[model samples]
Target: MEIKEYFHDSCVYFLNLEHRDDVLKKMSENVQEQSLVKASFGRAILDREKEFPTGLDTDHIGVALPHTDKEHVITPFIAVGVLEHPVSFQLMGGGNVEIEVDIVFMLGVTDPSAQVEVLQQLMEMIQNEELSNKLESAQTKGEVISSLQHFTSLMS
Candidate 1:
């Protein structure tokens, strides 16, 4: 599946939140408003994060890929959050290790098997320093979407 298809303009956000939970809650609410996920999505995602942290300490910046199981998703979507200030999140698979995250990609995938592929693509994208810089410095949602689309196009 094309990963870029999951991105929606309405799902892109410029957030100035102070904490990880707050950021997740806000992004989850937005996707819920768009009817992409069920109401249980927010709680499920939060719980999942606690169990399996998604924070990545990338080469260029700190990023987080928070997602839940397929059951909470009504439709697959990727919600991007560009934070004005860094929010601390527990490192992925690094117990008690925390990283300050600058960008967040909240994924809602309905297909269980496809989740791994989507995550792999996202992992590749996040590793690109240029794209990470563009996303972090993006002045508007359009810029963020444009960067992601361009990157995904190259992958195709």
Candidate 2:
């Protein structure tokens, strides 16, 4: 149930790289913050986002979950990138209108069934204001990972 179980430490980052393509750029930034296995990861999520759109507009805030094929992932991971600036993404729940996404949870799931579980866990985390606040304010990789671990553990 823990993100680390699926997402390795190498795959977790703060997203500090640059690129011409926004999606690739973001993923590169996240790679800089999180992993070396990022170019493919970013490309995958960008492609998926273009097709399926992972942006979600909840009662509390708007967020995006960009992910790609499991094969690109060395281990299952949910790389979280907190953008210093929000980006526009289409919402999954309603209209075509976009939302400013401050939090990006990139999921790397090999088993399709695990996708739902990850989504559910992410949804629960987003619903709690305290948890969301913690994630938004997390200044370090350890802080982000620990917070996610604490919440997921308690939920299970």
Candidate 3:
């Protein structure tokens, strides 16, 4: 699938939240406001993160991929959050180890089978240091979207 289709300008954010829960809550609320997810999405994503962490330590920066089940998703989306300050999150493998994350990609996936493909695409994009750096330094929502679109076009 072309992952760029999942990005929306309204879903991009520059967050200054201090805590992980707060960051997820803000992104969840934004997607919910856009009608991308149900009201339960916020709580569901928070609970899921507690059970299964999504933090990744990339070669260039720390990233988090927090998502909930399809039941909470109204429509598919990938919400991007560039934190002003890094926030701590548990590692993906049920480790007690924590990593400070600078970026968050909160995914809303309605199709269960597509989750894997979407993740694979995201992984590819995340591995590109230039894209990650561009995302980190992006000054506006449009810039963020443009960067993602540019990267995803390369994948296509």
Candidate 4:
């Protein structure tokens, strides 16, 4: 299963939101409305994120990987959101620690096993400060996808 198959130029977006819920809502709506996920997708993601945050804080960037069950997904895809201002999110596995997130990688994985591999790729991405910095600074959707091309194929 190629991970790049899950991304589309239409899935990339730039958002300006104040709260964590807004960020999740924006991305969830995009993925759902794009016909990638089911109608229940947004609600599932929001509920899941509240219980188990997927926030990650790296050296050059902070990101959240919010997702829910496979049942809520129709076609597996990813929605990229670059926030205008950093939004607060509870760090993944870091109790009581919050990070100001600049990006959000809203994952829509329909296959249960594929979830691990996707998250692995994302975790590997955060380690590369250069790549994350480029993505964070990217002004357009194409630029963001270009920055991620090293680790992900734009054409699947």
Candidate 5:
């Protein structure tokens, strides 16, 4: 309700992609067009995700947080992608755990210090199954935006 910081309307989308690369590419393109991130964002994310995964499998929903270093970002923006179907992504943990993630939160966090804060806030949302339910049930882009806005507000 408080002006919804970090949640940009242009950055939110409901995507239909069979491959994980497509999802990353879409977010990467949007970020570059919107001046949120540099052109290398897509490649960097793809490479980094291979080395250090970012998938989390919650009981309610599976999500992936794909991101790169702050140097590639021009401003802090949280891009939300609601995939039509699940796409495979490896876990950030050392083990070779693979998760089918339906939601992808591609973070273009310019500030170094805020990365942890943003992830912590997002982690809190991930910890709550109800939020995942809301996201899963959302029918429109507006509904997803509202869900994210509500989620961010509750963190304060």
Candidate 6:
């Protein structure tokens, strides 16, 4: 499925100023409003942070995905959070250093099997330096939606 099909334009956060806990909390709140994710989404984000951290420090840009198990998800959807102000998230690969992430692709995978495809597509998009830079600087909902659509189509 296309990222646009799963991530509606309405769900894109164009002016997110909060960082850390507030960011994650707001994301959880957003999903909680819909049937996509329940209260457990918050728990999962925190739990995932402790286990497999999603922060990425790439040559072009930095990004993060606070993903969780399917059990915490209700409906499948992605929360494309564009932080107007960068947030600090611990890097996953190694090092104790944290990166300032302007973009967050929070995955709500209701089906466990869908996680692999979603991650693979997301990774492909992340690997594109130009695309990653564009996404990092995206300031409008339409821009974010179009970028996600383009990346997903390319991957597919």
Models 1 onward score TM values of: 0.98, 0.79, 0.98, 0.93, 0.93, 0.89
Q: Which prediction has more favorable TM-score, 5 or 6?
A: 5
The prediction achieving the highest lDDT against the true structure is: 1
lDDT for each residue of candidate 1 in 83-125, tens digit (9 for 90 to 100): 9999999999999999999999999998989999999999999
Pick the winner on lDDT between candidates 2 and 6. Answer: 6
Candidate 6: segments with Cα more than 4 A from true spot = 2-4
Ordered list by TM-score, greatest first: 1, 3, 4, 5, 6, 2
Show where candidate 5 strays beyond 4 Å.
1-4
- The candidate maximizing TM-score is 1
Give the range of the ten consecutive residues with the poorest summed lDDT in model 2: 15-24
For model 3, how does the per-residue alpha-carbon lDDT over 1-156 read when each residue is reduced to its tens digit? 468999989899999999999999999988988889989999999999999999999889999999989999988999999999899999899588899999999998888899999999998989899999999999999999999999999999
Off by over 4 Å in 4: 153-156
Supply the global lDDT for candidate 6: 0.79
Q: What is the lDDT of residue 101 in candidate 1?
A: 99
* Better candidate number, 3 or 6, judged by lDDT: 3
Worst 10 residues of 6 by lDDT: 13-22
**Clash totals for all models, in order?**
0, 11, 0, 0, 0, 0
Q: Tens-digit lDDT track for model 4 on 91-156?
A: 999988999999899988989999999888877876788878887888988888777775675223
Instruction: Report the lDDT tens digits of candidate 6 across residue range 1-156.
Output: 555577877678755665666787788888888767878789779777867778887787778888888888888888888887788888886667788877888888877777898787777788899787787788788887888788777767
lDDT of 6 at 55: 84
Residue pairs with colliding backbones in model 1 are none
lDDT of 5 by residue, 1-156 (tens): 122577877888788888888889988998899988888888999998888899998888899999899878887888889888899888779479888998888888877777888888787887789888888777787888888888777766
Model 1, which residues run further than 4 Å from truth? none
